[model samples]
Target: MASASPLIDRHGRTISYLRISVTDRCDLRCRYCMAEQMTFLPRERLLSLEEIALIAERFIARGTSKIRLSGGEPLVRRDIIDLARRLGRHLGDGGLDELTMTTNGVRLGEHAEALADAGMRRVNVSLDSRDPEVFRHITRHGQIETVLGGIAAAKAAGLAVKINMVALKGLNAHEIADMLAWCADEALDLTLIETMPMGSVDEDRADRFLPLTHILDDLLGRFDLRRDAHRSGGPARYWRLAGTDTRLGLISPLTANFCDGCNRVRLTTEGRLYLCLGHDDQVDLKAAIRDGGLPAVDAAIDAALAIKPRRHDFRIAEGSAPAVARHMSVTGG
Candidate 1:
């Protein structure tokens, strides 16, 4: 077989990171992510595990170094560990540099050991609030004890954990300081993300869009924050906390656009290759692979890159439609 080509978008950005959503079904209904009632795709329509592995291998062969398995909740996918282990085979010398995952932590405790054994050095857990009531309110049915237990299990399994908190104005914004302090105490990194206008939820997204700038201003008074030049392969900007090992990462896509350095693309559960999260331009890699094999999959990827938008059109306003109709979970948050 001939060597695969590097994936470079039309704007000259080398795409080395691929986030694949293994499933579109999540257990929690985070207010910002989904509605109380969601209509998920039929399991038969989802790309088979074999198909997912094949597509992932194609990307790895084509110079993609990092692959993050994501989902509505990746842990909920059946036999997901087998798939993780299958993908883990590509994590050596000339293959993928990292195989990681992003989970809501509802099922992390049960799978942490297996995930670690599958060659994942680190994992990102989405935890917005440290308070039980706030956490339950945000996740709807999530129990803080379960998530906390999962985090502990992950730590005991020797996996480096990072907390991903979505900043919401009226909801858990007040808990940012507490979350950061807890992360520090637990030796975990915390990244704050501005609420994104993705899909339609019960409430207006503008009501919950909390600018990281406000949080930063409040934090500066409480903690000594110095700029840190650490790039974690995503859009988060890092700031080293004064005298602690904890680092606070801020992903301010609304207040501060980080599009110029964009090197990532998303693949939905059914094999749609989404070039940008904030936009809906996608290519069907599932069809490509099924109809014409890996070569066709490569062609489809190249075509998708050619049309990759320069920057996402993300805006939050009262009565304004979501930038895209798909939920963040659909695109693999």
Candidate 2:
């Protein structure tokens, strides 16, 4: 095996963002993230808190500053607050600049305060539909009331809350305006994400896939929104709702690929590190941790970074590329 390649990728980009999936278990079965009959990963295969912290420590030493805990639903994992505490300790003395999480918000109302106290800076809650019935239809078991309660609790806990909504055409497209209006009222940052053909969802259901451009155009027609200067970062395009403190973001990963400036690496619950969203290539850090030590784990991460593809070719025009088998839930957003 080749030795570690340090922090730089093949394109010489510095890797700083680390997205770690704590568990492959989620309460809801979102149509886009899991098959009808899902075979969740067994318990033994999941990475322990210690193992996760060790890998995080190694990466922090190598210049990683931002860490985001993700999952099939991060809150689904028992004692996730403990994992957050351990990670917070490892990231002491400004080692990690920011610690965040993305969840479906089913358990947020119960754990939000504890998570905020444990050194988490913010949270991004995935809520695609405002209508309770639509939410249930999309996520099989999700309760809009519970998610809303979670969002309120997160806000009360003092953690910066971002609401992520995937704007599917026939599914939740009509609710974009309402969602944005609700965000404005609640003073929460709302993000509209375009659907991608990367999960178990029916690819032929093209009607459900609404492009970001269309969403933006519709929003502009209805609201007096303007581009916000302060909220710009990563792939999310920010816009401020006129006369309100709330802001909106558009994450057009499919319509506008920001791979050139991409600086993130995703770690699955099973400990596989993926360099890109559209690629099957990965490095097994869990195996290294079980067999070797921190040095071995670092080497695996570095090798993965080195092999990180410059960009993903989704083949928009041809639409012939193979779909990404790892659902968004398993990969932890």
Report every candidate's CA lDDT.
Answer: 0.92, 0.83
Q: Pick the candidate with the highest TM-score.
A: 1
* Candidate 2 local lDDT, 239-307, one digit each (tens): 899899888888887788888888789888999989988888899999999998877787788789779
Clashes of each: 0, 0
Candidate 1 stretches with Cα past 4 Å from truth are none
Mark the 10 consecutive residues where model 1 has the least summed lDDT.
1-10
lDDT (tens digit, per residue) of candidate 1 on 1-333 = 245778899999999999999999999999999999999999888999899999998888888899999999999999999999999988886888999999999999999999999999999999999789999999998999999999999999999999999999889988899888888889999999999988889999888999999999999898888999998899999998877888899998889999999999998998899999898899999899899998899899989989999998788888899999999888998
Residue 74 in candidate 1, Cα distance off native in Å: 0.1
Number of clashing pairs, model 2?
Answer: 0
lDDT of 2 at 287: 96
- In the order shown, the candidates' Cα RMSDs to the true structure are 0.9, 2.9
Candidate 1 achieves a global lDDT of: 0.92
Worst ten-residue run, lDDT, model 2? 314-323
